[model samples]
Target: RRPRRSAGPVSEAESGGSQGVGAPLGVMSALEKQLHLGRLPPRPPLPGGGGQSGSKMRMGPGRKRDFSPVLWSQYFESMEDVVVENETGKDTFRIYKSGLEGPVLLLLHGGGHSALSWAVFTSAIINRIQCRIVALDLRGHGETKVRNPEDLSAETMAKDVGNVVEALYGDLPPPIMLIGHSMGGAIAVHTAVANLVPSLLGLCMIDVVEGTAMDALNSMQNFLRSRPKTFKSLENAIEWSVKSGQIRNLESARVSMVGQVKQCEGAASPECPKAIVEGIIEEEEEDEEDEEGGGSVNKRKKEDDTETKKEHLYTWRIELAKTEKYWDGWFRGLSNLFLSCPTPKLLLLAGVDRLDKDLTIGQMQGKFQMQVLPQCGHAVHEDAPDKVAEAVATFLIRHRFTEPIGGFQCVFPAC
Candidate 1:
C-alpha cells in the first residue's frame, strides 16, 4: 500500500532515503550539500538579442532542418537534467536556475504536452527574475514513459511530485511557487493540498479550474480520437496538428511535434489502393410488406476486400492509455482541492469563460487572486506568454518570492 499523506509537509531529514538522478557527494547528504552550498552546475548566460533582433550566429549549411530556433539556442544547454525515483517509478525534470540563493518555481505542463512547453516562458523568467525554475514531464507524458501503469490516481501522481520536490529541495528550501496549466493545474492543487512541498509560497493555475465544462472535456476527447495513430513525416504531423487546432503557432507546433515523435524501427510499408466492387444481385423474393408499399430488404451485401492494415512502428511518445485512466479523477480532484487546499493561490484564465461559469471567482476573490487575459486561448502561456510571465512575476512578488523588477521585458525574440 502507498503511504498516507501527512497533514503538513515532511522534511528530508525525516524521510532519509529519497533516490535521485545522482548520489550525493562524499561525507555529505544531498540535501545538506545543496543547502550549505551550490551543488548544481553553473548556468550559462542568456543569449543576446532580447526582443525580435536579427540572429548573431551564422547559418553555415545550405538547407536548415525544420526546428524551433528558440529551442535550438544556447539557453536550453544551461538547464540541468534531473531524474528522481520513488517506489512507483522514475521521472525527469529540467531545472533552469538563475542562482542558488533565490526562490524556486515548479512548473507542470498540461496533458498532451511535455516539460518543453515551458521552455519559452522559463527562459523569460530566468532572464528577468532571480529564481530557479523546474519543469516536470508528468508520468506517461514527455520522457517519463510508463509501462503497464498500475496507478493513475491523482493521489499517486501527487505523491510522485512530492517525492521529486523532496529530492530536489530537501527538508527546507527557498520559497516555492507552483505553476501549472490545464490538467496540470488540477495536479498542482492536489500536490498543494497534500502538503507535499513545505516551502510552497503560492499556487498558480493557468486556463484551468475545478468545474471545467463537460462539453469542453468531451470535445478534447473527441479531438484526441480524431488524431491519426501515426504520421509518416514530421511535416505531416505538424499539418495535422494545425488542422486539428491542437497548436496555433507554427514554429512552436513544429518543436512540439518533433519532441513528441520518434523514428520508426522498421522499413516504411507501401500503401495499397482499396478495390471497389460494382455488381449488384437482385433477390427473387420480396417482403410481404414491400407489396403493401412498405420498406423492402436490400440483399446487396458489401464486402471489405481490403487487406489487413500493417501497424506503423512510428508513433507519438504519449502514454495515451495511462492518461485516459485518470480522466474522471482529474476533474473530481480539482473540486476536492479547491475546498481543502490552504495555500495562497492565483488563478489565470484565458479569454474564454466556459470553464469559469461555475468558478464563481467573486466568492473566492478574498481567499485567492484571479486574473483573466483578453484575446488569449486555452494555452494562455503559449498564446500570450509575455502577459502570463509578467502576471506570474507580479504574483511572485506579492508572495515575497522576489522584489518588484521594474519594466519587465520579454526575454525571447519570439515573445
Candidate 2:
C-alpha cells in the first residue's frame, strides 16, 4: 500500500462486500471474493501526515485513521515459545494462550496469516466459555522459527502441530479442540487423521472448504501477485489492509496485522509497531470513508519520487506465491480427511456455496455440524469474531466439550 496525498472522504462498502451498502460501492473487490484472502477490488493508495514528508503531494482533508499494530498480550493471557525437536534441529513455534485451566482450543491460522489472527476471537470466546486457547504461529508464518520454513507440506505441518502440543502438554494432556482457518483448517484435518492430537476433542474450520479451496487455486497466483509488496508505514499497511478488505474489523486488523508483515531489510518506518494494552483497543466502523480515494491515490503515486516509494516500506513476512508448490497438498482430498477423522467436526463457512458435493452429502448424512455466517469475507473468524466465538462456544457447550464461564449464555446458529 502506498502513502500519498489523501482525497476528501471516499465511500467503502459497510461490510466491504455486496451487503448493507449502496450499489456503486457494493461490488465486492476481486480479492474479497476468491480464496482465503478472497476476492477484493484493487487496493487504493492511502494518505498519511507525519513522517511521510518525502512525498511531493500535499495531504488531503480526509481524516487519518490509526493503523498501529496491537500487541498479542492485549488479547491473550500469555505468549509462550515452545521448542520442538526434529532430525534437522529444534524449531521454536509461537503460542498465544488464555484461560489457565480448561479444555484447550488450539487455533491454527491460514496461510500468510499468523496466530494473532485469532486475537479477537480468543478474547471473545474465553469470556463466553470455560476453555483454554492455544494459538500457534505455524512454520514459515508469524514469529515461528523452523528448521525448514518452506516445508509447508500437510504431513510436515501436521507433525509440527502434533509435536508442539506434545511439547506443551506431554502424552496425557487435557481434552483439546483444533480450530483452524483456511490453510490451518487443512492442517487440522491432517493432524486429526494422523492421530497427532491424541487428546483431540473437536474440530472446527472457519471459511474454508475443499471444493472452494481447490477452485481458488487456479487464481491463487494472480491474487498473490496483486497484493502490495511493500507499505510506507505500519499505519499505511494497517489502513490498506482494512480498506482492501483483508481484515474487515479494524480492531482485529490492528492486532492481527502485526504478524503479517516485517520491516524491509534496509528500510524501516519511523512509526513501527508498538505494544498497547487491550483496554485502549476500540473498534471503529469507518468502512465508508474511502470511496472517493481513487483520484487522490493516483495523483500522489504519480507525483511521488522513487526515493519515497522504495525506502521505509514494510514487506509481507511470507510470499504466498512461493508456497504455491505445496498448495495442492494442502487441500487435495481434504474433505475426505476431515470426514474420516473420528473427532466431532464443525465446518464454518462464509458462504454455503463453498460446500462441495462430498461435503454437502456428508452434511446431509449428519456426519458433522455446519453453520454458515453471511455478510463476511473469506477470513470469517477475523471479519466477524464475536459471531464466530458464539458459534464455537455453542458447539463446544452443546457437545459437552466445555462449559460456559463468566455467566455467559449460549446462543445457537449465532450471528
TM-score of each model, paired residue for residue: 0.65, 0.77
On residues 1-415, what C-alpha lDDT tens digit does candidate 1 reach at each position? 2333323444556445453423233334557556534644554444543321222122453433343323524334355646776575665654443434467788888877767667667656665566777777777666664443345567877876787788776887668888899878888888888788888888888887766634466566676765566654556566555445565555566655655655455444322112222221211223243566644444222321122122333356664544665777877647546645677777788744644443565335466667778776577776666677778877776666685444564322111
Q: How accurate locally is residue 1 in candidate 2, as Cα lDDT from 0 to 100?
A: 25
**How does model 2 score by TM-score?**
0.77
The model with the greatest TM-score is: 2
Cα distance off (Å), candidate 2, residue 3: 40
- The sequence of per-residue lDDT tens digits that candidate 2 reaches over residues 1-415 is 2232232433553334442222222243444323322234455555543333222222345544567888888999999999998676899999998998779999999999999999999999999989899999999999999878989999999999999989998878889999999999999999999998998999998887888899999999998867776776677678777777777888999988889988766534432322110011111212232454444433434344243544455778988888998999999999998999888899999988889999999999989999998989899999999999989999999998888888978777632
Flag clash pairs in model 1: none
After the best TM-score superposition of candidate 2, give how far the Cα of residue 191 lies from its true spot, in angstroms: 0.2
